[model samples]
Target: MTHILMIPGSLRAASSSRATARALAARLPQGTTCTTADPGVLPHYNADVTDDAEVAAFIEEVRKAHGVIFVTPEYNYSVPGVLKNAIDWASRPAYESVFKGKPCLVVTTSGGALGGVRAQAHLKYILNGMLAVIYPCKEIIVTMANTKVEDGILKDDTVLDFAEEALAGFVATCG
Candidate 1:
């Protein structure tokens, strides 16, 4: 079974990004499990605090996962500050961190027309710097996300199909 760690870029209680993440989690292949990374426990990134228990545990989770999936929303044409902070924590030791060599997939959601394309590009670059092998194909970008998710579920058949196809592609590529 593939164990995927999902990280949402937004922390809002009703975040469209989180809804999309939940939707993807539900549509993953049988025997694959998805778990969200808890960002609340993560403090601001500081090299001196690398050994913090919460950070250590988060790193361990990333190391144990077979792959990672990021559900991101654009914030001022860039990835959210919290999400970036978490990544910064995991990108330590200069290429020897938990993200190194890990397979990753990025999914962006937005209420705007572009569907967080800028944030996705920024995330791809950041993952590159961390030596993470991001999947090239099977990219998911949910535009007008507000219309796709309802009450924490993705209700649109079109969006669901796209997510399912992208996830299947990721699984096939990794396994």
Candidate 2:
């Protein structure tokens, strides 16, 4: 069975990013299980700290997953600091980390028309720098995402359909 680890960039419970992740997880095909990681529980990244249980567990989650899905909202045209901190913690030993060669799919959401496109680009670049194999597909950007969610779940059929297709393709490439 293919197992995917979803990382939502926002810390808010009602955030579009989390809603997107929740929506996508519910649509994953049979035989494919998913788990969402909460980056908020992690501490600030410190190069000297090696005994952080949260950090270690987070890294292990990345290491064990067949692939990773990043659901994020644009923050000043870039990924949020919390998401970046989680990445920094998992990225260890320089070029050889748990993220190295891991399959990754990025989905960006926004309240604006641009749909967090800039943040998507930034995240792809960051993942590339870690030697992660980014899924090669048309970008998944959900515009006006704030209104698409209701009761903590994304309810847009149009966006959900397209995202489900992209996610299926992403799953096909997972190792």
Candidate 3:
């Protein structure tokens, strides 16, 4: 069974990005499993503090996963600090990190018209820096995202279909 590590970019209560992430996980194939990681719990990145238990655990999760999906909401046209910090921590040992050779997909959601595409691009660049095998599909952006999620459920079939298609590509990439 394929194991996917999902990392949502926001710490906001009832965040639409988180909801979209949950929906994507549910849309995966039956044999696959999705585990959400809490980037918010990671401390600020520093070379001197890279060996903590939490950091070790995060690295292990990524190492064990078959693929990773970063569900992000744009913050000032780029990734949120929490997500960036986590990436910084994981991107150590210079091309020898767990992210190396792992497939990664970036999905962005936002209330704005751009649907966090800028952030998605930024994340893709970051993933490239780690030598992660980036999924070849185009960016998946959930725009006007507030309308797509309600009560923690992704209610729009159109958006869900789009997400499912994106997941299919990601799954193929993972294989």
Candidate 4:
């Protein structure tokens, strides 16, 4: 079975990013399992406490997954602090980090028209620095998140189609 780890950037109740990640997971081929990693449960970045329960669980999730999907909300034109902290935790031991050679995709959502594009770029850079093999498919940015998602579901077919197309490429790439 192909296991995919989805990490949502926002922890708000009924979050659009979380909904989008779930919808994306639904589009994957049969037999592909998608699990979400909640950043809210994680502690702030601290190299000295890598073995903490939360960090340990997060690391295990990353190490076991076949690929990772990062669903993030933009904060000041960058990745949210919570999500970045998860990245920092997974990306340890330099070249030997679990992020090394791991397949990851960044999907950003925002209330604005840009759809957190800047944040996506920033995350890609950080992932690259960690030697993560980011998927080269078209970026999926769900803009106007407030309208696109309702009741914890992505309502726009266009945006979901974009996610579908992107995931197809991701699936192929991983397989």
Pull out the clashing pairs in model 3: none
lDDT of model 2, residue 151: 92
lDDT of candidate 1 over 1-175, digit per residue (tens): 8899998898988889899888889899988977999876799988776469999888888988999999989999999999999898888888888888898999998999999999999999999999998988667888999877788876777877877987887866554
State how far residue 151 of model 4 sits from its true place (Å): 1.9
For candidate 2, lDDT tens digit of each residue in 96-137? Answer: 999999999999999999999999999999999999999978
Provide the overall lDDT of each model, using Cα atoms, as 2-decimal numbers: 0.87, 0.92, 0.88, 0.88
What TM-score fits each model? 0.95, 0.98, 0.96, 0.96
Lowest lDDT sum, 10 consecutive residues, model 4, at: 166-175
Q: How accurate is candidate 3 locally (lDDT)?
A: 0.88
On lDDT, who's better, 2 or 4? 2
Candidate 1 segments whose C-alpha is farther than 4 A from its true place = none
Model 3 Cα lDDT, one tens digit per residue, 77-117: 99999999999888988899888999999899998888999
Give stretches of model 4 more than 4 Å off: none
Model 3 lowest lDDT segment of ten? 153-162
Pairs clashing in candidate 1? none
